[model samples]
Target: MYIRDKKTSFALVADKAELDYFHQVSVKDCASATVYSAYCKMTNDCPAWLQAAFWLRDKMSALANVENIKGFHNKKPDSPPKAGEKLDFFDVVEISEYELILMSSDRHLSVLIAINMQSNEGTSKNLTITASVKNKNFFGHLYMVPVRPAHSFIVNNMLKKVSFK
Candidate 1:
């Protein structure tokens, strides 16, 4: 890790890859991180709401004249990401057997999302998902002012709804 910040109450340890991703990102405004978790088969059958998030994101992109050049926004995944694979709404920044890093950027802002799965002592697996955002310009910050809260709400709801059969 390039820089170490105090861990949150959740004690989320940013992995080297995560830190590297952030290190490479340059933001005029603050770079923010938020984490969400769920008890589910994380490597498979990702939550529908999570996919819905991208669908909503695509509409927003259209309004801003950001074309979905990779066509990933509309492609829901049935399996874990491969190293060179494009994911639903973002480019595959990096990936490993246990970690998946996805990123997207426009004139206004850049975002990185990481999803990781680790086995616990019991039946359910622990899924940690983190999102980091960097603003490219003033409008990015202004647009995110209210959207930040809503973003948290959406992530919380998506995580809460994720469950395995």
Candidate 2:
């Protein structure tokens, strides 16, 4: 974790292997030290919204510390390296036709995810889909699919709460 040209023209240094490990991070790879140093050097502490913008920018910069990997978004490590909220993939409960969202960590992270969702205005993040159950089998199983001609699974990012996290 090297910070080039820090305050007073002081450059910071870190171990190469440590840097390499952090480079290949999942949500779990971020440790307390990483989160602290990653976010501590901020120059702004403005109103909520503006502060959020800066925090996200810092996150992007911190990504350079993480390793690049394909399908990294799709994978969840068994143990979390850092302590923060993360949105887990939606789990489709086969029979219920409803899903359980795997939101872990604190509410702030959930709010962040939901905020990110609404910012896109119904793009990328498809939080919920509208569908009907059909072809119910004798074994009490029903299929939930978009059979209606005009149907949309809209993501109401604003309504989503991160309290579960």
RMSD of each: 9.5, 22.2
lDDT of 2 by residue, 26-65 (tens): 1211212221121211111223543354355345534434
lDDT of 1 at 8: 26
Model 1 weakest lDDT span, ten residues long: 26-35
Going through the candidates in order, what is the number of backbone clashes in each? 0, 4
What is residue 142's positional error in candidate 2, in angstroms? 42
Tens-place lDDT per residue, model 1, 57-113, is 557767777664433233345454565566655667666554556666778876766
Candidate 1, number of clashes: 0
Candidate 2 clashing pairs, residues 3+ apart or interchain: 23-65, 23-66, 23-67, 24-67
Q: Using Cα atoms with residue i matched to residue i, what is each candidate's TM-score against the true structure?
A: 0.56, 0.16
Q: For this target, which candidate reaches the highest lDDT against the unseen true structure? A: 1
